[model samples]
Target: MEESMRECMRKLALWHTRTFKPIMTHDELEPIMATLGFLGLPPSASPGGSLAWKEYAHSSSSSSASSGGGGRARPRLPYPRIDGLHSYTYQAFVDGVSSYLEMCDISVLFHIRGMPLHRLDLYKKWRRMQEDESVFVYREGTLDQATYNLYHLHRRGGGGSNSGDGDYINVKMYYGSGDGNGSLVIRDKGNSAPVSCLVPLKDIIL
Candidate 1:
């Protein structure tokens, strides 16, 4: 068992090194977060004239969640610390999906380029691959930014490194284009050489 654990860890590390490449940028991350509504409340103009009202609502929700009253509260999820929008072409998005999967400890359901990958076979294989390894792989599909319900994979675990390596962490994001497809980014923790994929905007949960 010890040996097996070591092997898994070793493979995981190796896989991360090979599959995880630098993609995306701090500037690019901001817009994606904003579009996804992950960034805390933006400035609001009101009689109070302060962001306090936004915080109040956020705090209320958090407090309710803490009390365990079974309120469906949005958990505080980790997002990029950097500021700005992630700009990448659609091709980049597709390549990045494989890397995105390896970085997740928890499952992430993402929609991109009008190809929602919710089928039982896809999800099952994704979970299975994730449990035993850490490399990105892709299967060919007719992914267009239009006329398709984009697919996605999100990490349920708070976004962080599994290896405790400060150099890199796995990250994901969503982008909005006027086209039917939105954008999804999966790249290194440092936002280098990211693989950006497009998804049909209609497929996004929001």
Candidate 2:
């Protein structure tokens, strides 16, 4: 089972590199390509079938020659940032493709990711409910700082005090919305007002 899972992940990674890399615009692909390069893999070719490696190599050689033929300095690669795509959408795409290749249900991806069996069951149940009405359930102390920042930014104005009590905020998910794009809600235990945060589906972890 472990070996099979690894193979699925490998195929998924390769598909992401080959399929999305060529089509994404420079601004969209920059971070992903940088991550691939940092992992000692070749960055994807551009839509025109050209890679920037030649230019980078040329600049490195020129710098080495100018410094009296010392060994060429490595070019600095850009760091990957998660800002362009919606997390849930990306994960769903990956899960869908992987499910197709593995000949398994999408829930298998969630199971492999360590999501609780009960939460999975609950989500499945929620899918069959009415569109306007929904269920909200949450786990306490699950809010990470990065995700909190996303919530904070979405709220726009804030004067909420930060707590250092080692107690993190609650993370909630709303299901059965009209659009079916459920929301992530965050709130301090002491505060009655909660902020609706847009978090990546994978980040929910349960």
Candidate 3:
């Protein structure tokens, strides 16, 4: 059992060094806290809203498993620190980190295009497209109405038509006479006309 435990620790350390270390940035304390939480480890407060791991295994193992036995009692996990720090369970940590990463990726996409980060559906669609390379070409005037409709459907929590609704942004493409030249007509719902003039394809980022 001792050997097995050592092996487990060894593997975990190796995995951390190989996978986690490469991706971790110096400023990513939240991600470190999140990773510890996902491993069911306790966290103590640190500088700059960061968290540090607290060794709790010894204490947890020493706790009583039974009081007077009306039923089989279990040891209680430690509570969050008294300093009003954020604490999380394994699943909660995973969820929070996943959400944060998704938002970060979405932000990068919007930043690349110099677009405002106002549309949740658009972000979702972009993420999906990233995962599936065959979905759509990443170029100007490649964003079609179908993709927008799909984005809208997903944003509405997946139970709707492809038709225009008040919740979706509508985009139209216009091709110019010159090769590789086009413009986009963008309009939001509940608007009488296009909100902006035709934007040139070359001006947009992928």
Candidate 4:
């Protein structure tokens, strides 16, 4: 890692060591993004007929709060349509986001730092379309700050877009407790654990 990147990791480690503690539930954590100036990151656009999608995805799953069914099935809304994108859609983005959360363990430093979230080549596996997208992840637990910083570097293009034979960024995803402070993670190539960064949607080009 470059000196600047290493320094960033140290800072993240310090922050994590200091703030490691219990985290709030997803409901309590959503508001912090807005309060922390991430409100405009992306407009809350749900796609039309999402209810139908949910109804189909979990047709047999029961809507029990005690069971694991409460958090996954969300009401569908109208989202913006990406013109000319062969496979991109709000559903793909949502699927990718869900996979990241379900599969990746965001608490460990080395484990989380090795996630392949930005690998467009593996879009088919993640069930995402080839189009512009924005995603987010949040959880509660202890994380190695340096690992988190490495993830941010990947997301911000600091990690050169190269991974072996494929053109990609080798960065792992990030994890944050729902306490307002958090990191963003993306995938490239097959799967990459990326560095974390606070990317505001207003600054995003896609």
Show where candidate 2 strays beyond 4 Å.
1-41, 45-79, 82-84, 87-92, 100-103, 107-206
Q: Native-vs-model 1 lDDT? A: 0.26
Regions more than 4 Å wrong, model 4: 1-54, 57-60, 63-101, 105-193, 204-206
Q: Write the per-residue lDDT of candidate 3 for residues 1-206, one digit (tens) a residue.
A: 73332222100000122232311122233344344332223344433433343322212223232221233122111133211111112112222332323332221111011112222323221211222222221222223343345444443553222211111123332222222112234545468465645432223223
Model 3, global lDDT: 0.25
Best by lDDT: 2
lDDT tens digits, residue span 1-206, model 1:
73343222211111112233221232343334344333343322334332111111122234323221233222221122111111121222322332222233211333221212223323321211122243222222212222122222211242222211111124343323322222234454465565544232222222
Question: What's the lDDT for all of these models?
Answer: 0.26, 0.27, 0.25, 0.26
Q: Candidate 2 on 1-206: residue-level lDDT in tens?
A: 83332222100011132232221233443344344231122333323433222112222234324221144223222122211222232233333233223323222222111111232332221120112211221222222234446434533443221210111124322222332222334444567565544443234323
Q: What range of 10 consecutive residues in model 2 has the weakest lDDT sum?
A: 159-168
- Total backbone clashes of model 1? 44
Top TM-score prediction, candidate number: 4
TM-score of each: 0.19, 0.18, 0.16, 0.22
Question: How do the residues 14-33 of candidate 4 rate in per-residue lDDT, one tens digit apiece?
Answer: 00112332112223323422
Better of 3 and 4 by TM-score: 4
